[model samples]
Target: ELKVEQNPLFLSMQEGKNYTIYCNYSTTSDRLYWYRQDPGKSLESLFVLLSNGAVKQEGRLMASLDTKARLSTLHITAAVHDLSATYFCAVVDAGNMLTFGGGTRLMVKP
Candidate 1:
């Protein structure tokens, strides 16, 4: 079975602070993605980490994948109020389907 879990489902993140979100999966996966969704909005792509030690980042968000360990990470730097949103990590399975993590909602106070 393939499963993914994320920590701190509701993150009351402080502004200008750094934090890391963890994703742990049950099976070996080759592809991983990080996404962000704002209130009443569709998902926005953040990063796609494809292989072991793979890392990708844009602005305040950085994501890394460890295929051997079945893990992924999303690190945030200097969080701001606008960065408050729901974050999701998804993995592509052997059949090329996506399994999404339970979303993490981050609220950053100004």
Candidate 2:
């Protein structure tokens, strides 16, 4: 069974600060996806890492994947209050099933 864990499940930071959320999986996976969810809202796709060393960035958010280590990271640069949301990372297993990590709730204070 594949298990996913995210460090620092809750993060509170001030605006203009930078932080990184890490996702680690217990098994091998070729595909990883990062998602964001606001309060009372559905999940929104953030980044997709399809291969080892894949990296994607948009605005203040950057996501990277290291398949060999079964790890993925979501880095937030210059965090703003509007960027406050719950972030999740999901890994696709060999059977094409997605296993999601425990979400990391981020709170940005202005």
Candidate 3:
């Protein structure tokens, strides 16, 4: 069985600061995805890591995957109030089932 864990669970940061959110899984997976969600909105796909060492970035957000370590990271550069949201990382198992991390709620303070 594949299980996912996210560190911090909640993050509070000041504007212009940088931080990294981590996702660790118990099993092997080649496909990993990152998503963001606002308070009451549906999830929005942010990144897709298709292979080991895959990385994708948009705006001030960057996501990377290391399949060998069963780990993925979402790094926020120069945080801003508009970037406050909940983030999640999901892994696609051999069975093609998607398992998601617990989710990290981020609050960017001004």
Please give the clash total of every predicted structure, in order: 0, 0, 0
Model 2 C-alpha lDDT per residue in residues 2-86, reported as the tens digit of each score: 9999988999999999999999999888889999999899999999899999999999999999888889999999999999899
Model 2 lowest lDDT segment of ten: 27-36
The parts of candidate 2 lying over 4 Å away from their true place are none
lDDT of 1: 0.90
Q: Which pairs of residues have clashing backbones in candidate 2?
A: none
Q: What lDDT does candidate 2 reach at residue 11?
A: 99
Model number with the top lDDT: 3
lDDT of 3 by residue, 1-110 (tens): 89999987999999999999999999988899999999899999999999988989999999998888999999999999999999999999998999999999999999
lDDT of 1 by residue, 51-101 (tens): 799988888888888888888989999998889999999988999999999
Q: Give the TM-scores of the predictions, in the order they appear.
A: 0.96, 0.97, 0.97
